[model samples]
Target chain A: MNKNEIDNANKYLSKFARLTRNVLDEKELISLSQEKTLLDDYLQMEQLRFGFKYEINHSEDLDLENIEIPSMLLQPFVENAVKHGISKKATDGKINITFIKKANDLALTVTDNGNGFDTEKKNNGLGLLLSESRVALLNSIYKENRFTLAIQSATNGTKVSLTLSDWL
Target chain B: MRAILIDDEISNLENLRTLLEKHCPKVTIMATAQSVSAAVDAIEKYLPDLVFLDIQMGEQTGFDVLKLLPRRNFEVIFVTAYDQYGIQAVKFAALDYLLKPIDIEELINAVNKAEYKLATQIQTSQLDFLLQQLKKTDTHVSTIAIQMQSETRYVTLSEIIRCEADNTYTYFFLANSEKILVSKSLKEYADLLRPNGFLRTHQSHLVNPKYVKSWLKEDGGILLLTSGEKIPVSKPNKETVKQALQRQ
Candidate 1:
């Protein structure tokens, strides 16, 4: 797992959550979260196709209000890594996602041990562009808060990290 | 018999209400709808025996509403403007449809047919199936029937100038300086003809393509038919008439 994968995953989740919020009300969002296990099952099947093991870890008392994040934000990035990033690899790989609160900031990391890429030169497609726009919108709404993203990749794997102020 | 009246225009709704009350005393209007959502709610709630459906209502067509229903339990008598192609499709499908300013006689006849069909338990599945096929084939028609004197006459596909509602009867002005009347309301005609070439230029007038002579912009605009009859175009249909005329 590397920084670039973790960053991409966090970015994708933020955007997904925002888009889902626009389409659904609060009650619907709660129901959608209840189906997270179903999503996990789907992600597992996807991992099998990619010859990779998928794992997700979340802090028991993670403060959702502290982030003010959109709905279903990180799900897509995890999905994309399993489907597009890891599936193309030659051997078995692994994707690990971790969520933690550090002081007044929330940090989400997604790491995948698969094919790595040159993030400096590659242009993020529509998906990444959408993620950036949503994050910017989130920043505007939570003025005091800052959103940080870091993507790093090596020959072995990629890791992506996203940090947002607790005031989010 | 239970019936539902659907039309966005208040005048058309009133006219149909009057005609139904006078001619078909047995028909009790269960409800009336002025928009697609309201119509859907009405249809589901009332489940009337008959529905007086208007085809064109803003962005949503009558067909779109029909598609939303669970099943075709009620008989639909389409009320629309003069359009030859649509009339032909109705005829071909053996479905009952009426052109606008509805005549008392035609209204009575349609009601009688609906009643008889309902009484005999005549299956409308064939007509429904045919309509589906027509939609799939995209065979939209644009002609309407005109009742001249006592006999029903069909104006040619391209010869119709426009149709105007005069009380219960609709007058059809053709290219050949011939005027004919039909026993149906303008909403009925509008529904039937909207799919065809006839555009509802006003609440009273459904103008055809071949007979539009000129457009007068002054005093709320007027359309001069080829027959030189000046027809008052309503504000709502101004853009539609303009677009139809451009196509011609």
Candidate 2:
């Protein structure tokens, strides 16, 4: 293998190790910055694996280091997009993640350009199911700011958005 | 020892090759296949002593390849990335599996285990158990392979009443009043058993809802089991435990 490829591989290994460590951590909550770092590591590793087949973009409008949310709240949704959406597409797949401050709510969304699932049908995907329960668990823990999830899909693409009401 | 690598993804196969070359020098890679048909062909031709099999291919799985080769003359180690069902089946058989972005130490350990099993010519019943598990659609009827210090025990889910965490180890409390100590954390088993009606009522206690006799609301909540054991339920999980019990 080329030295560049080896370097990329090493980076992938270290990032993956950190991701595993973060996931296995027993902590219930983490900062927005820490969560972003987790997603950054995860997406970077995926980029190494998939290379130029897909593109990912990120945008945020919040104090990442100060605001805190439930740990691993967004990972499953991104994983769902990668596994069910872009991975199956032939080429030129795109994923966009946005974190926005809307009034008293925090809005996080992940959109992907791939074959989307039927919005009317109940998704039985394991990642989706796990995240659904996780949201419920979080709602139980922090009953103040109710967390709501909305998913929209069509044949061309899919978008998943989560709104933490009165969180900001 | 000779080995064959089978993965639909070229990069993963490459990664495995690099790790094997760097860490496991005792084994020789005879062939690599990317699809089920190719894997079957390579295995038939090479007749490898060991195989590193990927769980998911295009439309088929590695189990399909295993099914085609009925004769059990080779050792197998499964490699996959976040395949819950596949990993569950493999774990239930006490088989070795490496998750991708594969850890070098885990890869080395799996290789060493495969090498030793091949050398000893030990007939593994794990494959048969795994195949049986895959055949069964209902997980409730399936048996769980519990790895102990000296031997692996296969027991059904209903047989286990609860699990208690002791630091890095977990103790399995069975309905037969027998206890088995496993070297894995409570969190791991909690993940595996969550879908099967097990409740994580506390950080240190995982209870099977089937064995719950009654819920005691006093003393910060406790579950009375059919086995006459009182399992403590934590404050946060009390609501969940109550809901789960109500659903039963």
Candidate with top DockQ is: 2
DockQ of 1: 0.01
Write model 2 residue lDDT over A145-165, tens digit each, in one string.
Answer: 588999999989899999988
Provide the lowest-lDDT 10-residue window in model 2 chain B. B141-150
Displacement of the residue B187 alpha carbon in candidate 2, Å: 0.8
Model 1: residue B58 alpha-carbon error in angstroms: 2.0
Where in model 1 is the C-alpha error above 4 Å?
A1-168, B137-248
Which candidate's TM-score is highest? 2
Enumerate the chain B TM-scores of all models.
0.54, 0.86
Q: Compose the digit string of candidate 1's lDDT tens values, residues A4-117.
A: 563334334433443444335342122122234434645654643566777777666553211224455565566656655687763567788877768646677778887777
Candidate 1 TM-score, C-alpha based: 0.34
What would the per-residue lDDT of candidate 2 be over residues B1-248, giving only the tens digit for each residue?
A: 89999999999899889878877999799999999999999999999999999998878999999988877589899988764647778876778888777867677888887777777666656777788888887765457888665556888998899998776688999998999999877766776787788998876789999999999888768999999999987654677788899999
Task: For candidate 2, give the lDDT.
Answer: 0.80
Candidate 2 ranges beyond 4 A from true positions: A1-8, A11-70, A73-168, B9-11, B44-47, B81-85, B113-123, B138-141
